[model samples]
Target: MNLLKTSVFNCLFVCSLIFFLFFLLLFPKESFNAALNGLVLWFRMIIPALLPFAIISGIFIRFHIADYFSFLFKPIIGTIFDLSNEGSFCVLAGFLFGYPMGAKIANDLVVDRQLSKNEGEYLFLFCNQASPVFILNCVAINCFKNENLFLPIFIILLSTSITIGIVLRKFFYKSLKWDSKEKVLKSLNDNTSPFEILDSCVMNGVDTILKLGAYIILFSIIVKMVEIILKDFYYLKTLIIGFLEMTNGISYISSLNTSFQIHFLFVLFCVSFGGISCIFQTASMVKNSHFSMIKYLIVKIMTAFISILYGILYLKFIY
Candidate 1:
């Protein structure tokens, strides 16, 4: 079964890449515009938001700064999540920095042995989430055209990631736990000077961000091709767009003549799922680590569905 599934996935992936190449050749204008949009977004929104956090998170991990979390904050957040100081730091990075950053930080922690292998894999699953700025500003105001919609969207997205993480932790990863006292920070990176470490982090962060930009551009082009090919099946086109890359999907969703409920649910699903582009970016980040991309993808699909369920309840009761 596993071999069959892997073969199927490989076949689809190869076909998709070939089709994308066809898109590049056939519709150069559309593809150029799509690439431009993705590049502009990466330069304007993603870089400013992520680069600083990326460098900071890397420095924090390298310096074992999480070990010095304040007495007030540490006891509450650390104990609550059953995380060591480092894991608690990752939660903050996840919430604040968003998506693959949390995953990157979690992978770093496991490499540094700040978290056990089970804990690290478990941490990235849920800690990886959409940015608050993207949720509140991009999706809520820009796409939905209503700032008031932020609360419901925020609640649903946050709740879904947390709930999914908690359920998986309870069932499959029974052995993962953090004992702060037991953790001893040891690092092979200790030989580096502060300057070297800072330089390395900045370089790595920029490289990661560039890869993210590439995925975004690649998927943006693919989504544009979807637009032309599936114009008759509007709903299907939208789903395919949302599945490929998130930002373009949200922009496309906004321009549609759908009902408010449709807008809300599609945005909810796109943000919740993090899109295929997001999944690929995340997988690249942890490719060297023990983290499971398959598990992450499965959980993301689950999150998308759960977000819609939450959206339904919210729309029925609260909206």
Candidate 2:
């Protein structure tokens, strides 16, 4: 059965790659322009926003500040998610910074042996999120043209993430057990020099950002091809693009002359989903680790559904 599954997957992957390459060859100019735009977006927005957080997160992990943070938040995180102090740090980072940061931090903890594979996999499910900054500024204020929606949207996303974390913890409680508590405690006692740690953090942060950028560019090309193919079906095209890359999807939806409620709900759903581009970036982050992309994808879809339902309830109550 395993061999059959692997063979089927390989065939699908190869066929998909071939189809993608054929589009690239057929529309060389479009593909090139899309790739360039993706690169520009990365340099102008993604790097400035994410690099500092990534570096600080690395420094925190290297100097064991994350361990201290984990310790401080352990009671709440432990009770809710059944994570150790280190895993708690991953959750905090995800809540604050968002996206592949959660996956990156989870991978880091797993690499350092602070979290067992099960714990890492569990954390990976809900820790990867869209940052509050993006939600408030881009989606709420800019896209919806309503700053009032910020609190509701933020609350919805946060509640959904926490709820999913708790649910996953309950479902996997037995399998998600931690390793030695002493080892987790000992991680807080790192003896590395500050300078060395800083250097390592900077390099690691750059490497991670670059890898993230590549995925963004590749997916941007794919999204562009998809857009070209589905130009007539604007609504469906918007959704498909959003499924591939979230920012583009949100921007497309916001430009439409739709009702405010419909626009808001779609944006909320896309932001909650975080797009296939983010999933691939996250998958890359945990590629060598024990984290399960399938599990993460399932939890993300659930969160997206929850976000839409919450948005509907909020709208009914508010207006």
Candidate 3:
């Protein structure tokens, strides 16, 4: 396995280097311009989230607040989803934070031997959705320009449906099981210094953010290239463009003179798939930890489908 990883990494490094050189040779003007734009976008969207998130995560984990919250949700989780306390706690955190942060928290708890790896794996599907903060503030209010709280509400509902399907499949249907005999819970020592947690959080955040930025730039170039090649193909371009670039996809769908149902379904898919850019960027960030891209994608696709179903039902009831 180690040998395979090494070989793969070497191949990727070489391929990327070759691509860079070839791009520079063939399209120096575009390459430099694209690189500059990438840097700017990285600074704008990626960098700002790094330090603050790190520090906040550190404080939460270090203070044992996460554990406390986990305990509080234990009963609700057990009753509702038949999940463990740790799982519920991580789910709650994911609801508050977004993407890799949620995944990161679960990863940390697993490493600390607080939850069984299998349970962590199960919770991961539910725990890896857009936070309420992002959906409400960033997407619903800011992006959609509509005050209808239903947007975020439906997003949460759709996310929940996706998580449920993933859990059911992994645990019972798909027969994909996590290692059950890994570890047990830990008593958080009060003496664990605050600085240590802070340092870990900041370092992890920076590393994750930079990794995300690398993927963002790469995927952005791919998106740009694909858009140029298929400039005339409207439907294919719209679909691919939406998948590769999230906000742009939403904008495209919104501009179409289509039915409300189509628009709603597109929005749901954009939120669920989170675009190729989002997936690539997020996968890059959380790759260091025990995150499963396959499982995540499965859950995302399921969520998109469920969101559409819910929208159909909603429209039927309204009409």
For residues 10-53, could you state the per-residue lDDT of candidate 1 as single tens digits?
A: 99999988887888998999999988988898899889989888
- Candidate 2's C-alpha runs over 4 A off are 70-72, 174-177, 181-193
Give the clash count for each candidate: 0, 0, 0
All candidates: CA RMSD in angstroms? 2.5, 2.4, 4.6
Could you give candidate 2's per-residue lDDT for residues 68-137 as a string of tens digits?
A: 8778789987777766678888998988897878889888877766678778888888888999888888
TM-score of each: 0.91, 0.91, 0.77
lDDT of 3 by residue, 142-166 (tens): 5556658545455556455545745
Local distance difference test values of all predictions, in order: 0.83, 0.85, 0.64
Ranking of candidates on TM-score, top first: 2, 1, 3
Ranking by lDDT: 2, 1, 3
Q: Which pairs of residues collide in model 1?
A: none
Regions more than 4 Å wrong, model 3: 1-42, 46-51, 141-143, 149-159, 162-193, 285-291
Error of 2 at 92 (Å): 1.3
